[model samples]
Every structure is written in C-alpha cells, then in structure tokens.
Target: MDEDNWDKLDEEEDEEEGDFSEPETTTSTEPTSNDYMAGAILANGIIWLWLQSLQMFSGFTSRISPSILADFTAVTIVIAGFISSQQVAKRSERNQLIVALRSALYSWAGSLFMMLTSPNASITFSLILLVCLLAGGVLGSYMLIQMRINERKRKLQASS
Candidate 1:
C-alpha cells in the first residue's frame, strides 16, 4: 500500500513537470477590430500631418513642377496607406490580399477626408492619389505578411 501511494505521488510529480514544460510558441496574428481602427486612425493622423506640412510649405510646392509634385504626392499617399494598414494585416498571412485590400479601404478614409477638404484639388490628381493609396496599402501589407521574417511568434501573448 505504501509503495502504491509512493508510485502515485511520483506520477503526479511527473505530470506536473510535463504540464509546466517549456512554453509552446505560435503565431498570434489574428487581428482584432481594434487593429483595423488603429490602422485607420494612424492613417488619418499621417495624412493630416502631411497636409499641414504641405500647406505650411505651399510656396515650396508652388515653385516645384506640378507634375512632379503630383507624382511625389501619389507615391507618398501609397506609402502612407501601406504603413498605416500594416498593423491591421500583420497577422493575416493566410489572407493577406483580402486583409490588405480591406485595411487600405479603411485607412483611405483619411485620404478621402483630405480630398473633400482640399480647396484646389483637381479631379485628375484626386483620382491618381486614390489609385496609389489602394496599390500601396494592398501591396505593402501582402508583402509583409508573406515574408516569414516579419511574422510575430508569440508565446506569452496568448497567456495574457
């Protein structure tokens, strides 16, 4: 009887040790609604700051060739969209394309705000910026997600 009790105690100790063994690592990229909202807010803030700076340096912009400025602005918008939406699609490696598209659309609301408020924006320029933002957001997010190097391996996040 004593030997049986001792054996059971040993087994319990082994079970406890096994249960507490090294934490397993898994990718916890499942994005939440807050992630999307955060992306949108980040995008809006970036556009707002960019617009403010452009207004402050209106003279500099005016001196530059309009075509050059337009192209530069398009590129900037795309980059902004990409960066802003990155957080939203960081964990969506399997569905990066769709996530990227949705993230871009959500973040593009800020750009839309800029378009509506711009006193002198031409239709051509606005359309160009729109397309650029779409391309940037989707392309950037997809690339980041597809690249295994950028994947977030979480061991503790799930515990918390």
Candidate 2:
C-alpha cells in the first residue's frame, strides 16, 4: 500500500521475470478421426504383408486353417478397436461415443478396402471382423466413459 512496499514488489517481479529456465512443453494435439483411419489402414497393411511373407517364405499356405485364421483375425480387429477407443477416450473429455463410431466406421471402410484389394481372406470373415471392430469400439468407449464419470462423482461426494 505504501511507495516502499510497491517499489520492492516491482523489483521482485522484475527479478522473477528474468528467471527463465528451460522451454515449456506444449500441450499435445488431439488425435483426429483421420489418425484412426490411417491407423486402421496401417494395421490392415501389416496383417496383409505379414501373411504374404509367411506364405512365401515360411510355407504357411493352407496349413493355417480357415477357422483358426479367421478367429485370430477377428480377435485382432477387436483388440485394435478397443485400443483405438481407449486412446480416443484418453485424449477427449466429450464426444467420446461419436468419435469412437466415426473411427470405427473409417476402420471398417479400411477393412473393406483391404478385402477388395487382396481378396485373400473369406468374405464372411470380413463381415465378422467389421462387426467385431464396431462392437469393440462402442463397448470400450462406453465402459471407459462410465468409469471416469463414476470416479468423478465419487470424488465430488467425498470432498462434499
């Protein structure tokens, strides 16, 4: 309130302003739907390339039974979907469901494109893989959102 105090405070502020250390880290950019779509395409490519390599190099032809292969592919798709949803949920606080669906839709399109291009796997299996992806994305996002909401509610109640 006095001139002496005001001058001291101004000097302190000046000293603090000159004390720069390291550069601050910027906030991470949010993941977009295109990222998810690109991820799906990349995953499909990896799967296709890996299978082709096995058949060509390791003699993994019809040795891999259709049922077992299809099952494995379906499981992989579900896990990818779940992981994608988890990433989306972690980065975003709202629009989790919408984002998940949009990502899943793009992922399904990628799968369809892969099947059309290669036609190595069965058509029925592709359909099953698409369903698994959509289901996993939706269910995984829902579960994470619910858990976070419940946790917030509990924290608020405890503090109250």
Candidate 3:
C-alpha cells in the first residue's frame, strides 16, 4: 500500500508540472490585440517614412519638402504612443493617459497622412482635426490624472 501511494503521488506531481508548462506555452504563443495593433502601426509608419525618403531621393522636392519633417514627427509620436499603450494594457491597468494618447496619436497620424496625400485639403478639415486631437489629449491626460488620485485615496482609506 505504501509503495502504491508513492507512485500515485509521483504521477500527480508530474501532471501538475505539465499543467503549469502548458499555460506558459499557450500564453507565449497567443498574440494579443494590442500586439497586433502595435505591429500594424509600426509597419504603417515605416512604410510612410520609406516612401517619403524615396520621393526625396528621386528629386520630388515638393513631395519631400519641409512638411515631410512634420509627418516624420507625427509618425514618431504615433509609434511611441502605440508602444506605450501596449505596455500599459499588458499591466491590466485602465489608464486615461494611454487611451487619450492613443486617440491623439491616431487623429494626428490620420490628419498628417491626409494632408500629405492631398496638399489641397480644405483648411476647415485641417482645423477640425487639430482641434479634436488637442481636445482628446487634454481630456485624456486630465481624466487619467484624476483616476490616479482617486485610486490613491481609496488605497489610503482601505489601509486606515
């Protein structure tokens, strides 16, 4: 009876080890939505930069003029925002800053792309996009800071 119990215990331990290993494999292999979004944004930014560089190299000075610098800045900001958002999302923390940053980045990137592709874009459209981006950035940052303060207050109360 003693030998049989030892064998059974060993078998159960092996099964437990297998269960732990399976989760590690599955979690590592599964790509989250944030990962996909970050990849897409990075790819889009790289392609845009590459196209601009090509235009400049081909003597398309108008297409690669001073405005190209602004587009580059927008791309950099958007990519950084996407990366930051992904990191924050992984923490499972709902943050307003991340949400607002994403919103602002998307608006800015889209507006920059539109302006670049259509230099004749209406002034009204440009103004609207800029306003929306600014509003989202301000609102998001403010809300997130408030949330952090609230969380700290709650924690303090609980500890007391």
Candidate 4:
C-alpha cells in the first residue's frame, strides 16, 4: 500500500511539472472569430455615430430630428452589446475587452438620450458625449488590432 501511494504522488508531481513546462502560445489566448466580428461591428458603429453627430452639427437637422438620431444610436449600441456578449464561450481577456467597449458605448448612448430629453441640456453635455464616443472608438480599435495580431500568430504557429 505504501509503494502504491508513493507511485501516485510521483505521477501527480510529474503531471504538475509537465503543465509548467509547456510554452506560452497564442492558441490558449486567441479570441474566436465571433470576437473579431463583434469588434468590427463596434468600430463601424463608432464611425457611424461620429458621422451622424457631425451631420447634426453641420445644420442637417432639418431632415432628421436629433431625438430620433439619438434613439437610433442607442438601439444600435444595445444590439451590438447583446450580440457580442452572446458570442463569449468563456471568460477571457477578449471577453473583458468587449465588455468594456460595450460599457463605454452604453454610457455614451445614455448621455445622448438624456441630453436630448432634458430641458436644460447644454453644449457641455454634447461635448462630453463626443469625447466618450471617441475614447470608446480608440479602445475598440486597439482591441481589434490585438485580436488580429493574435489570430495571425495562431495561423503562423499552426502552419509551422
């Protein structure tokens, strides 16, 4: 019985050592294709919002009401967040980044909605929304670039 116990302990130690000896690789950390798609959608939405905001500021409000534009932007962001959250299989750095992007977008959307609905809305609130949107866009772009790089590394590792 003592000999069997010693053998089991040796086996466990060997397994632990083996686990530590493996090289760190992109395969373990790379985001799925769904993450890539979500990031792309977020980037495009940011661009769209920026253009719409610009149009509103440039005297195109005669065609579309600002309230309608704000509501559309909010809906777009909520849909993107829902789709991106659905794509996550497990918690990971990629998932965390997506969550952060979603949060930022949601905050911007809420600010826009409040500004449009409030009687005391001012230019300061609009400027804050613009800043948040720009910051979120930059963050989304960074995450997307990181995901692309990791994917390339994974492909190269597979081919080699």
Off by over 4 Å in 1: 1-28, 113-126, 149-160
Candidate 4 C-alpha RMSD relative to the actual structure: 12.7
Answer with 1 or 3, whichever has the higher TM-score: 1
Tens-place lDDT digits, model 3, residues 1-160: 9999999999999999988775444434333556435533553455356556756676555556667855654455445444434433333345545554554555455556756776566776556445544454555456556767899999999999
Better candidate number, 2 or 3, judged by TM-score: 2
In candidate 4, which residue pairs clash? Answer: none
TM-score for each candidate, following the candidate numbering: 0.64, 0.59, 0.37, 0.33
The C-alpha RMSD of each candidate to the native structure, in angstroms, is: 9.8, 7.1, 12.0, 12.7
**Per-residue lDDT for 44-89 in model 2, tens only?**
6654665566567545646777788667766766777776655655
Model 2 CA deviation exceeding 4 Å by range:
1-31, 42-66, 119-122
What digit string (tens of lDDT, one per residue) describes model 1 on residues 1-160? Answer: 9999999999999999999999987677767667777887787677667767778999888899978866776777787778866667776746766777777777766556767877876777656656776797777776786564433444345556
lDDT of 2: 0.71
What residue pairs are clashing in model 3? none
State the TM-score for model 3: 0.37
Q: What is each predicted model's overall lDDT from 0 to 1?
A: 0.73, 0.71, 0.55, 0.56
Task: Candidate 4: list runs displaced more than 4 Å.
Answer: 1-114
